[model samples]
Target: MPVVPVGRSADNAVTTSPQRQRPTIAIVGAGIAGLAAAWELVAGPDSQGGDGPEVVVLESSDRIGGKLRSTEFAGRNVDLAADAFLAQRPEATGLCDELDLTGELVPVGASGASIWARGRLRPMPEGLSLGVPTRSWWPFYRSGILSTGESLRVATDLVVPHRGTVGVTGDRSVGDIVGERLGRPIVERLVDPLIGGIHAGGVDDLSAAATFPQLIAASRQSGSLLRQLGRARVPAPRSAAPPPLFWSLRGTTASLAVALAGALARRGVAVHTGVSVDAVERAGPAGANGATHPSWTIALGGSGPPPTGAVVMADGTSSLRVDGVVLAAPAREAAVLLGPLAPVAAGLLSAVEYASVALVTLAFDPGAIRSPLHGTGFLVPRISTFDGRPALITGCTYLGRKWPHLARPGDELLRVSVGRFGDSRPAGLDDDELTAAVFAELTRLLDIVGTPVETMVTRWNGAFPQYRVGHLDRVARIEQSVAELGGVAVAGATYRGVGIPACIGSGQTAARLVLESLSAGADPAGRSPGRVDPTR
Candidate 1:
């Protein structure tokens, strides 16, 4: 097969035609990563008189958005999944704008949040990002979140020498770093639960450097993490937005997948589902005759279009020989697929651990609980979330108050969080038992009580990745290994962050990498795709 030339022309008009001849890109996953990659390739400029770059996205799942799963429950819609992205998380916000969805964004209202700690419900001390108290003094002396002595210790976070010792694995676990720097009180009570809970990683294994880059930057940049946080600013208020609260599509995060999928379809991407790729072996370049096109023997064993270029794993399964392959699966999953392509990367991918988590959504007659369900719920400190025990409730979002569609007069919507992986799941406990447990805990701490009108429980094993200290080295190693694989790259929460924004950014980054590789006349592996573009 003769090497198909790139620089194909872009009509750039509203019209899209499958004129063929342009470089073909195969995207394996339809998830955000894959979709983003495919969109990037399709949107690239090609001078050829023919069509622009072509993209094919293959997904194994019937639907898309791995782990960002959301399903309908009760007469109301429960996030049964992720509800919002931090306003500060740039990646997700940027993607929304790029997708023209930024206007739809809603910030969690300013009603404020609380933390379930030290046997009670206390307002999240102002100046706290996650559990790291930005304002050490107020919380230290006045807040109920920590004891006076504990607060002083936390406030002394100013003086804790940076003791982030790298482990033999050559990385620092969040456990050692935070413990050394902030001490046990902060780590056990707030840091562990708030920050640690995000990735479901315990302090001992979470990577402070990789997982919480900003936090580390805070400490390094300002000499004190507390000081850096003390300056943290909330996003400006907006009125045109719906409810001005952290928001999600009335459906589920799945709506994001649907929107992207639809957008891809409109953009002329060939989307194939139920396709399973066994293995990806590099095929030789197309001969000068052009009869033998650079292709992938679709391992479907069943049937499908014989594969080709810009292989994007939108759904996370790694496969294809194209301009590039962007992996968008969990780190462990990436580890399994890229093992042969990049061993160290595979090792690092495997090494970057994940924690299991469970989310329980309990519905109640608003009047049932002691206090009116307000603002966002509370976070159970790691001590409470850990202890191999789930807090009576990690936090409850007043769903109705959050999004207008979620709740209304006479009806109420409340989502109760339960277990974090490594913490005991709410299994074995019946609905009544779980509800009672939550109530007991809530009552014990918040001084509220009432019976649930209805309840829902969910458990996610390895919900998010815990980038322990030295995670950067691990990721760098993995990147080098992937580079050697020729046309493959990895992206997603497993590498950078766990928020919807970060993941979306990962997808966009992977897309840009693919674009850059293309313009450089490099194949998926950075070599010429088919013919040596001597010009380069």
Candidate 2:
């Protein structure tokens, strides 16, 4: 593929248009999803055709990785955001295999996290599926996380079973289904801490269809929810141990993004950081041969390096005219960029909400802890209180214990997470105040003796997008509106799943969508024939 020369212009209009051999696609945002999209454009089976599309990725941040980041802590590299990805989801592991990093994939060293209930840390019950007891009731009853009355309420599911509708209904909140079946106590104690913690929001408003479809599917059965979930479980061989629940790279899960960015760069894809996309608008009318014309114009800002093939306007701004575009940015940013082209998509994207969270990593002398660190970590339900107030810390991870590679003889590393949807207490406190408060809670929960040897706080504002009831419908509308713009698509956690694997899948899917649109010579104002499947 020949490089499209950069041309300077005194006006906002594109000044150069030379015949090109391959289609050029610009990907906005350099996060995992965006990087994944660029990879697909340059190396996927479709890209194997002749010369692949000229791909360029732009990010507003100074670095390539978005929320997937790691830093040196206690003489080892530790992840500040997500530490691992679900092994059941193949995207992350498949990406690792493709990058030849499969050998570096490491399963979590520990298991069986506990929950703080009734003023004590109790081991989470076994045979639980996303916090709902799927197997026998004996294990859950013996865990002692619930009171006698609460246990009896849970037993009602088996004795006097609550029969839900015979078929799958419209979207319902996770909290409503679980509370109705098992009891409110179960939702408050078990379900909220596990499922709710994943999205950093309460389950009461979270959409079951979007978040936990397994639960929703099981709920539709006539009999017990527990029995239905148990039947749905795919059994493993009795002779072998179960597979690992989660996996991370040897260095850190963050390395997945780093490795992906490197791989994209190696494929001749221009990956630029600290560059923000200002707007995405239609260029002039299609050429006599519609397939050859660049249909979209992307306005660029920020002090980041100019795109290698961008047209430099006299106003000092950079712009790229591309055959297609993938708006792989965050929901808010995508909304702003799509406002001029797709007002419906912009409005729906703007309405999506996000949750902020802080992870405080602290290292303490091994001897300072009174009790032995067990399992990976423990979760604090929103209802759990500390010192007569609602708990400030949502959960805590024994980083060194969970990832043995990070363990040191001198100190034990702990990561404490705070804040969630509708929780503003953490936002009010500065780093020092937040760290101190988290430590105080840790001191009581873990029976720590003194202060930490080192402390670091990482804040991820607007990190987790809430999947409220009817979220999937909203995403469908957003996708449909954008599809009408022809050769453009949006991808990210805000539209689909938020896990690393989900984000990767979302990006690849978006790539395929735009590629189809461009190859078919889609009309900019006409409906796209191949709209993305929202259920994916």
Candidate 3:
């Protein structure tokens, strides 16, 4: 494999000739998904044309990393959004291995978290799978999140006759399934807070298959969620405990993106930031390589098409012809690009909804809060209300306590999350208002006094995509429709799953789909006989 020179040639056309030209692919949106796709294309075995096809990553934003950004505060590196990834998920950890970042992987400091429930902070129940009590009845009964009666009702699930196959094959809301088996109290008090925190939406509207596939799989295996969990549980050995469930790069999440960007540069992959793709379409019958597949023209912010032997350029906006495209932007962004070419898949992408959230990170005097900030911060139950008003703060992460590397003696860093589905108040509030509201609540919740030494409020609008019931089916339809287009594919938080690992997996999958079509000499304007399944 050899390095490929990047950028447009002297005549403003792609440098390679049709006879020996390598296929070029464009990746839109330089988030984790797009970067991961590029990594797979350049670093994976399938990459052709010396090391790989000429790759170009276009980012709408001035920088990359999207939600995986980190900033320095309180004399330590702090993640503005997600701090870590599930170590059990092979994609994220696997990508780290490929990047030679395994040495920097550090496990989370402390494991368990607490919940503010029933007018008090209570420890979360132990041995629970996503808040479904599994090992014993005592944990749930004592956790105080659920009433004693509710705990007993949940325990009865072990002997309760298996319900009809609602979740056996089809889909159901997480709230519906959990409520039916364990009662409303467990669903509202326990499951809703934990799962809802992840999606920033109500569990009643979240897809059981997409959100809690383990529970669905368990339901099929044992007919009872509780029984299946119990049977699956492996007690910790007395002599040694298990490893941490989550891990992060020691340099912070943003460092991973920085490293990846550096790797792309070294591989001669052209990455252009602050470039918005207005639209994408099939250019003609053949690509720069004179192949049926990979012939696509991207409309830039400027107007008009590129002249023959010259890439379109107007007011710093230029259109580039490519062999294949990976639409790794947000669901809505992707829909806008795909609407003109593949309306069915565009509609499905449009149907995928999103939830916005705000993270208010404050650096407060260590002496201001007297209470022992135990564990990782705490989650606010969806049902929780303050002053007869809904709880404004969704959850809080005690940065210093949760990760020892960020610990400092004089002050503490607290990241408070606000907003969720059906809750538009936080979104409407100004940053100052949001900070004040969150600060007041934090003071009350943590028995803190005085003001913060510093504050930073980061709002992620439409950052989380809501995976409603039948989400998997919807994704399949979207993929099928995209596949029919031959050279175009989509990947992001909108499909399959929304976590870091899931997004990475989707990107890698999308890259393969597009490359396979290109390599097979498939048609770009119509359905291809050699289109590959993204799931495989």
lDDT of 3 by residue, 51-108 (tens): 4677888887778887889888777778888888887779998988888999999888
* Arranged by TM-score, best first: 2, 3, 1
Q: Candidate 1: where are CA atoms >4 Å away?
A: 1-20, 43-51, 157-171, 218-225, 228-247, 250-253, 285-298, 301-323, 372-374, 385-393, 424-450, 522-536
What C-alpha lDDT, on a 0 to 100 scale, does residue 210 get in candidate 2? Answer: 90
Candidate 2 achieves a global lDDT of 0.84
Residue-level lDDT for 192 in candidate 1: 76
Return the clash pairs for model 2, or none.
none
Better of 1 and 3 by lDDT: 3
Q: Which tens-of-lDDT digit does each residue in 1-536 have in candidate 2?
A: 21333643322223224445677788999888999898888877667755778788989889987888999988899998989999998888888988999999988999889999988899997789889888888889899999989998988888785667866669999999999899999999999988899999999999998998888888988888889888887675576667888998999999989988888878888788878899876774345244433367788899987776677666778777777889888899999998767778888889989999999999998798887677999999999887789998999999988998888899988999999999988889999999999988887788888889999999999989999999999999999888767778899899889999999999999999888887666475542223322332
Ranking by lDDT: 2, 3, 1
TM-scores vs. true structure, each candidate: 0.79, 0.94, 0.91
State model 1's lDDT. Answer: 0.59
CA lDDT, candidate 3, residue 296: 70
Please, what is the whole-model Cα lDDT of each candidate in the order they appear?
0.59, 0.84, 0.80
lDDT of model 1, residue 424? 60
Of the pair 2 and 3, which is ahead by TM-score?
2
**Cα RMSD for candidates in order:** 7.1, 4.0, 4.7
